[model samples]
Target: MTNWNATDLPDLTGRTAIVTGANSGLGIATTEALARAGARVVLAVRDPERGRAAARAVQGSTEVRRLDLADLASVREFAESWTGELDLLINNAGVMAIPESQTKDGFETQFGTNHLGHFALTNLLLPHVTGRVVTVSSGAHRRTKGIRFDNPNLTGEYSPWSAYAQSKLANLLFTLELQRRLAASGSPVRALAAHPGWAATNLQGRSGSAVLNKLMAIGNRFIAQDNHAGALPTLYAATQDLPGASYVGPDGPGEMRGGPALVGRTAAASDPAAAKRLWTLSEELTGVTFPAKVKTPK
Candidate 1:
């Protein structure tokens, strides 16, 4: 907690880290920071060429691999093929505020790509994820009612913004519940969640929806901080003296955006009961269980 900025953090020299969506924006910046800090970083992305380019930019040991969260089959393949120990797993890859669609598995596109895919991938890689798992949830999560276990895929009427918010809430819920189960089972791996605090990333680009696009454009033009700054909170969560289920983000004004550092807030994202319920629902949906993991706290 000693002014825990990315540069002030621990050396990840011998650690192996996997960062999803490492090809661009906050993900790319996060990958670069970790690599620079001496971690052997694996660039997991949906685009191979982009991933390789990203891998080349990193300053340390780097590997580029394909990981399409839109396709559960691909997520499974990527996780299974990846072997060996993992010191950090950054579930940073995500799709936001997009048109209504579905994943290869027919789940609502946002929920599938943002939550379930990461859920399954984390489980598949559990044997390797022996150190920490940092799920990148968002402040947007504060806007949602929480994970819709009753209809996670959004089979009925849907709103893209609400869907994205729900997915992000799931991200936090996943992190909290994962830690609870790990503690119960006596595993040492810590689970943490982080947010970018409205940074200016390519992911911040305008969406198909006119109103949302206008809002993004305004943010990008006015308040959004650069990607490197946005990545700090994540970096803090991944390597610092973190507690289980901690939330980290920007240390700037209103946390809208700024330098990588440990900041705090406990909203609906910190609700324990909601997190546990979501955990059980995720395991049921993914058909994957943490073998060493125990029951989530009541």
Candidate 2:
């Protein structure tokens, strides 16, 4: 809690990390910081060229691998091709406020890529994961009332912002429920969540609204923090001695931009019933159930 920042990261000599969406923004910063700490970082990005460039920009051991969170097959392929123990799995890839669209698997875009995709990737790679699973949620989660399990895809009446809020909320729910299961199974692996607050990232440009993107660009210049600053909370969550289900974010006004600190989530994000329901739904949707060890508590 001493104004944790990237420079404070511990030496990760033998640690290995896989960071999704590592080509730019907070993902790139997280990847670079982890690499600088001596971790062999994998830049899991959708674009191989961009991933390679990003790998070049960083100053430590790094590799590039293609991963499209919107495509579950890509997620499985990445998981299947991995050959060793993983010390960190940073679920950092995501799209925000994008126009209504379905992933290759047909689920709504934001929920599919941000939550379900990471859900499948984490479970498939869970066996390889020896340390932690750090998922990136968003402060936008406060926008929605709660998860609508009955219509999680929002196929009925689609609002981009609403879908994004649900996806971010699902992120926290996934972290909490995953930790419960990991503890029940007596696994050493822990699940944690973090958010970058309002940072200038390519996520805004990909949302498919030119006007909104322009507005956000201007806002980023004036109000948002830089990507490196945004990545601090994630690095803190990944490296800090935090409990399972802990959430980290910036410490600035309204938790928007500053040093890293543990932040609060909406009450709806802590609903155990909703988390369980979403977990079951994720398993069914992805056809990737986590291996059972100790029975889940009733």
User: How high is each candidate's TM-score?
Assistant: 0.92, 0.96
Candidate 1 is scored at a TM of 0.92
The global C-alpha lDDT for each of the candidates, from Candidate 1 onward, is 0.83, 0.91
lDDT of 1: 0.83
lDDT tens per residue, model 1, 1-298? 2344567757888999999999999999999899888999999999999899878877889998999988878988998898778889999989887878888878898888888889989888877777789999888887776677788877776887789899998898888888887887777889898999888888755368777787887987798878887888888888878789888877678778666555654467778998888878877766767666422223
Tell how far residue 187 is off in model 1, in angstroms.
Answer: 1.0
Tell me the TM-score of model 2: 0.96
Candidate 1 residue 249 Cα shift, in angstroms, is 1.3
Model 2 per-residue lDDT tens digits across residues 1-298: 3467788999999999999999999999999899999999999999999899879989999999989888999999999999888999999999999889999999999999999999999998888788899999999999999988889899879999999999999999999999999997988788999999899998887667888888998989999999999999899999989999999998888988989899999999998888999999999999999876422223
**Candidate 1 Cα deviation (angstroms), residue 81:** 1.3
Give the number of the best model, judged by TM-score. 2
Candidate 1 segments whose C-alpha is farther than 4 A from its true place: 1-4, 259-267, 293-298
lDDT of 2 at 22: 94
